[model samples]
Target: MTAPIYVPFQHCDALRTLAVPYGCGIDTVGVDPASAAPAGIPEPTLTPGRYLQEIRSAIRAMRALHDLLPPTA
Candidate 1:
């Protein structure tokens, strides 16, 4: 058995063409919370309710930003 290969998200498009022939799988990673801390800034602590509220607020902001972008093909 072979282990899966980790390919960067940006390079996945190129790898797609070779993945099947090589009989290997490619995976991409998402956010690494351990490294998400801002430089020179301390992380904040939040209760469960506050955490959920913050997450919801972020989603709303992202949706608003996405709506501002022009339509694409």
Candidate 2:
């Protein structure tokens, strides 16, 4: 089976412009759930339940999009 095409971070804007022609949309995930403790940065202090919920939501969104795409050729 062919793998899903992966565009680098720098090329994201280009992908957005080309998405229409390619019949695909971009999905971005910027959060790192593994980092529970704040590292000098102002971040939300989510309870374990909330953290897991956020992760589940993101995964659900991605999976939904993946299901819509045609299988790799």
Candidate 3:
């Protein structure tokens, strides 16, 4: 895990880490789902790390393209 980055506006003390199924993004990472259920928000399956490779590839491509593009005014 990467070192925690500080965001001044965030309440770090209030953050809670909940375990979700592997590869599934946690909807209740910070807030409990039971509290949110009353709002009618249906939890959806979130794919964690599925598109990560593609994202890293895209970023690398962008960095490569940056060197190829001529400098702008």
Considering every candidate listed, which one attains the maximal lDDT? 2
28 Cα displacement, candidate 3 (Å): 36
Which segments of model 2 are wrong by more than 4 Å? 1-44
Rank order (by TM-score, best first): 2, 1, 3
lDDT of 2 by residue, 1-73 (tens): 1111112331344343556348566564444533543567654455688657656655655565556557998
**Model 1 misplacement above 4 A:** 1-45
Each prediction's whole-model lDDT (CA):
0.47, 0.47, 0.37
lDDT per residue, candidate 1, 1-73, as tens digits?
A: 1111212322343244445346566554544433665687664554688657656655655565456556899
Q: What is the lDDT of residue 5 in candidate 1?
A: 20
lDDT of candidate 3 at residue 73, scale 0 to 100? 100
Judging by TM-score, tell me the better candidate of 1 and 2.
Answer: 2
Candidate 3 backbone collisions, by pair? none
**Model 3 misplaced regions, further than 4 Å:** 1-47
Determine the C-alpha RMSD for candidate 1 after optimal superposition of all C-alphas.
Answer: 12.3
- Report the C-alpha lDDT of model 3 over 1-73, residue by residue, as the tens digit: 1111212112221121112113334321345444555577765433456346445644555565455556999
